[model samples]
Target: MSDRSATAVVLGGSVAGMLTARALASVGVRVTLVERDALPEGPEPRKGLPQARHVHQLWSGGAQAMEELLPGVTTRLREAGAHRLPITTDMVGLSPRGWYRRWTESHFMLLCSRDLLDATIRAQVLADPRIELVERAEVLGLDGTGSAVTGVLLRAHDDTRRTLRAELVVDATGRGSRTPHWLAELGLPGPEVREVDSGVAYASRIYRAPEAARDGFPVVNIQPAPRTGGPGRGGVLLPIEDGRWLVTLFGTRGGEPAATTADFDSYAREQLRHPILADLIGQAEPLTEVAFTRTTANRRHLYERMSAWPENFVVLGDALAAFNPIYGHGMSVAAQAAVALRESVEEFGWGTPGLARRLQKAVARPARAAWDLAIGMDVFYPGATEKGPTRAERLVAAYVDRLTYTATGNGRVARAVTDVMSLERGAGVLLTPSMLLAAAVGPLKPALGGPPLTGDELKRAGLQ
Candidate 1:
């Protein structure tokens, strides 16, 4: 281990990297965040993240983690046009089980442009004097071996070779991370890998909100059913800041949506299970052109379960696990993972033996929960079930479908489902005796035939 214990090389500049660096900085570790692309000065796009062109949601679980790491982060995000949408209550959703009643807010989600969200978190992390960034720097490999990683080898993003080293290394490089290659180079056995590709594609566009319906707008969602043995199609119309609505429509494989504005309206109106989202956007003016991305996949690298992991090396964020964007769990899970890292570091103190291993294992605990949720549904896609869903998968999916169906009317079941959706509680919470009984009993109240929007909401949106 390096004697100074002052500097750590953080590979990546996205939310996960920034948050990880922020966590390290809080513990007195001077961090250098390496980014191959130049970060935007404001809420703008960066080359590294193509998904930024799409709408993103920050779940309450993630929001809570971010708030803990950086005080007033949610406030900052909201001040920048991000909307904190309450769960179930604020969401009009149709699940595989049935139409979810617009019950009271069980949880909440922050809706906004990916660029603005990144910029907000980036600015806060960069403001910390101890956390510095090395733009145009690319991580090459590890400096040490299986026993313990001494540092990282980095080069100018443009340089073909030559690298700079640090005392400790963190891989927060997102879904495309090369940690596996680096580990092989160090002679360490590669960790197990798990993936469930939903064959999901996302098409998103920004809309100028009408003069009226700006504040207190609800989120509209229609989920696809995997059990139907047909393509899953989903849509969302969310209220962001600056009088804008970020609408994203997505489908699996054959049902993939288009990015063209013309198709945006048509798809929403014709393709989706509900007409609410399409209707909402019909009244709003088109802002930016539509953006399309099909790279959304459910993948996870089991670094924590590695038989022989090097010390002084850790992974966080998408680099460790990535989920389908449709679920909107990525950011929140990243924040939660960063918190695990922070707590682990605090427990062991800096440079303690087995600290990195302990943190990796601890962080993976929540990661396992999230990965299970994403792949559980994703693996049911047509091509997704190529390998076939396990017996456990079918069982769990059935129970979840029942739970979602129950939540449509039963507030208790709705709360239980929301607790997991918000990620406020673990999956085990749903398996509780009360939840099982509730599921068996069915919804206690009658289900709504349509969205639970009040007459006032319709008036605000200029609904005919």
Candidate 2:
């Protein structure tokens, strides 16, 4: 099939799905997006996105890819009240080893409510004449043999079922995707799967930031110490649009926070490693009730490893790999995968043999980078896996733990670590001889006794 004449069907209207449709459309492929929910017309709440209530940020790496897919998207987000905050420079974080000093900016993050981010991108993609949206519909299954997918079996909201044939079918449905069952029905062997459940529960709430701290406020993160031989606990305070600070408190297994508003403040103050989050929230007025969820787990399906693969079908986003939100790599990896999809189609003709397999493998590259980062810490948690972390994981974690410790006081080491953490560079950067020497030498200065918040920030938050 020629690129201009090719048709594609994208399942799910998520960030991944929307970006996939945009990418295909950019390559001259007509795209149909099937969504189960009636998407909100603006930056308002919608169903099936429970995690949207929590803190969400796009690291510079992902933001760049989104910009490539849809030009001027970041500008639109800024016009709609998003903030582009430089990493480390605009961040105050406490890692497992110690508090990270605010170093010069090496990368950045796009900060705002997930609702605003989605609405901006949605408006941009839907305006393209090559892409059509089919809302309030359910995707029943794939419509061909295990060797190839010809189309999809879709059911409308009114129980009307139909087969919509297409040249390509992309699955971007999130953690609840049933593609495995659908593959089994087509007589294909199941893909290798792995899950690392940290048993963390998230409770988030919004507050009106104190007037002095409403604008140009730094992101405050108190990260969990996973090696403590106890349930991990952490919290983050993000100053988003409309002068609101979105606060999310999380704890693993035995340390999970309570869902009630009464316990929210106490958990941040007493349960987490620091009381800064609690102090900041105390000075602000509550804007919404606590939003809670415990579905945070790192799960991956190795579809690319399958010996016999189907053509014209590819899985992207959370359907291929879902990470614990604590790491905040899910959206970034999905954006990168969509970029890979577009580039693959451009490089190899869309109908080339083995194209689907090539796309799946290409998509896994970003997911693998993110998976290692998440499992490095999560795998050490109690009961994260039945057999515990592999020997390779333990060795890698030991090195990463040391590097993280060195990053606390060394500016050069901090920048190197941020490169990988931001997804701009690969994990191999940490294995360089220079990095090895830096880790062995340890931090150049003594550890900080408190969060590295400036005096001005303290005064603004009324903590001083």
Candidate 3:
């Protein structure tokens, strides 16, 4: 660890911010985490995190990164009731191409409510003496010029305002970040932004699983066929902690799910391409009202592409790029970016002249991978962008569509696809010569006739 006595002020105390604080503290940086709301002491809901009610899973790619940042945290999450689910193996999904065969596990995901995931990480991060929590404090703005940010201007709940100085400042605030305005106030040029809005609305609810099917239940997903040119509708039933299933139903623009209890079951039963999710939830009992959100736009602020960046400042997580939650890449990308943040700081030393810029560029790698995966499909939605997907995006989507079809009948191809989907590998893996040849030959085996649920599973869920 460097003995430079580096200090950092990380804005926002969500998953990204907490992971970032933990990362910096690992390198001996004293970190102050600023949050707009008081964090909960346990795995309970907190204000301002409406998305916590929705389905959240930490992919193995991210789980590994989180483990590196906070050792033994994964075991803690498991101890707290988070489910360790192996991908493809623990998944019963109907893809646009066909039903995906449940192959041997290539990766895994940690399933639980967002609240539990956040609280678990928060507990571990706060236990470190190097990090301090500044709750119920609002960040007014940066306190320096375009060339450098020396501190943050903060307002307490009592309306008292003061500037807190630090050698480094990181913005881990989510999609609602005001970094663009903050940068402009510092006389910096605004970063270019790209947004692809599918106009997708989400309605999620929790269900107490049927006693016999509560544990070891597979995650069921009904993916929409976006190429059909109709309003895409999809649903996912994730078996979370406490023997509960978190189900989220979503539809693009015209076919959006209603935020009412009465319409929830109907949409799941009839609107999606498959009714497996509905069938699974049919034997369960509702535990919570529908939590709805329309903030699923794919937005990216190209801070790395900016001609100039302020020193001692960096941005990470959703502040850099926010994806449609349906893809489940946001949290994984944030975890990967936090790892990048730490590695970059270590490589260049915390106070290096261009360290902040290097960090910004480094974090963008994982964000770009996830952005491509999300927008590749979302851009096909009607009115997603003023101009439809670019020629490149269309071409890539076509190839990916073929790859998905091949994956359904090819275990090797499925592993490669999941490698990228789990954020464990890059999209370039799909373009390898072997992969291309495999896609060309198409599925080596026949497509699955239906979801590969065992007889016992069917009986347990009362779907037999």
Candidate 4:
């Protein structure tokens, strides 16, 4: 139980903000969430989240954490038309080495439009009586010196300015967060930062799924091979709600996908390493114009390594680290970080000395794991970093490449890889003695010549 009545102010009202609010409220903290825009009352797009039009998946690790935070949320998502896809069983993927055979289910993912996912979670989080939401309110700055954060200054929609004092303040303002500047205003030194930008651009569009394929369709993906030493291109056909398919195509630097709808199909078919995504979507009816974005960069703020820190200020979600959406780990990492926040508050009790620093370090554990997974491949792209991948990064990438190649023809190896990809297990699982031995033995079977889609899937998609 908490030592006393405590109040917390959470900045931003997106997934990260709402989840953090719920976590804080769960532990007897009165939370006030401030948002710059008016939040929608239903499952609709908001001006703040432009990337919601593209593909988004919540892996099992995140799903479990969400369920723990808000009971029965998964059921609500399903009732609203979200699909729970089994890991490799419902995935037809082409890796750089070759097509990966569909293996038995090891984990799962929740697939739906980003708007629906966000709205569902937001609705649940805001229903708590202890959590208050302040919409159309802009956060001006942190109110305190470098040693301790006292509260925040805010300007309301009516141009009224005031300060909201709280025992704790949290920043969940996504990638555009001004946390670094806010801290600097308080005379605090900024944390070390690292960025790996692949110059990847994404173009996505929605399509009405074919009649027979609407109920159950596998996700189709074609991955780019960085070893080719040129441009990298890829595409994914994600079956979303409303019997629709969200097709997203991406390329780095020289091979970026065009913004015109006329070229969407050709880019998927001819530009990617495989043509499965194009063939599947070629016959489907297009439903929306292409939505393109170029904000796909992997960045991390080393807050845990800072020599000095504030007493009651913490940063979470993309405000702390933002990864390329291609890996689909952003939402998952946010949920896990929220869980870490809850655990830290419960363990140390709110307002305890050094609680903020402990929570920051705890949350970074999951973020760091997801960071390594994303940069493992992103760092190899041409012009991704100021300097090329360091020697250690190169060595680690080579080992991971071997594991990926072996996963194509080995079921055990594939499960091990998915364990890490699902965010259910840490990367240490791959370094086990048994896994090392399996990699040494190499793949037990020959590489697949083509995508391992079942006959029914092919027939339904009109590819047969």
lDDT of 1 by residue, 90-127 (tens): 88777776777777777888888888898999999999
Residue 69, candidate 3: Cα error in Å is: 0.4
TM-score of each: 0.96, 0.99, 0.99, 0.99
Q: lDDT per residue, candidate 2, 1-464, as tens digits?
A: 36358899999998999999999999899999999999999999979999999999899889999999999999999887898999899999999998999998999999999999999999999999999999999999999999999999999999999999998999999999989999998999999999999899999999999999898999999999998778999999988999999999999889999999999999999998889899899999999999999999999999999998899999989999999999889999999999999999888878999999999999999999999899999998888989888899889888999999999999999999999989999988999999999999999989999988899989998888
Kindly give the stretch of ten consecutive residues in candidate 2 with the minimal lDDT sum. 1-10
Off by over 4 Å in 2: 1-4
Candidate 4: where are CA atoms >4 Å away? Answer: none
Worst 10 residues of 1 by lDDT: 157-166
CA lDDT for candidate 1: 0.84
Q: Estimate, for each residue in 1-464, the C-alpha lDDT of model 3 and write its tens digit.
A: 56667799999999999999999999899999999998899988989888878888888899999999999999998998889989899899999999999998899999998988998999999999999999999999999999999999999999999999999999998988999999999988899999999999999999999998889999999998877777889999999989999999999978899999989999998888877887888889999999999988999999999998999999989999999998998888999999999999888876889988999999999999999899989998888999988899888899999999999999999999999999999988999999999999999999888889999999988887
> Candidate 1 or 4, higher TM-score?
4
Model 4: per-residue Cα lDDT over 1-464, one tens digit each: 64677999999999989999999999999999999999999999987899999999999999999999999999999999999999899999999888898999999999999999999999999999999999999999999989999999999999999999999999999999999899899888888999999999999999998888897899888988876778889988899999999999999989999999989988987898888888888879899999999998999999989999999999989999999999999999999999999999999987789999999999899999999998999888899998979999998888888899899989999999999999999999999999888888888999888998889988887778
The superposed Cα distance between candidate 3 and the true structure at residue 380, in angstroms, equals 0.1
Give the top-scoring candidate (lDDT): 2
Task: Name the Cα RMSD for model 1.
Answer: 1.8
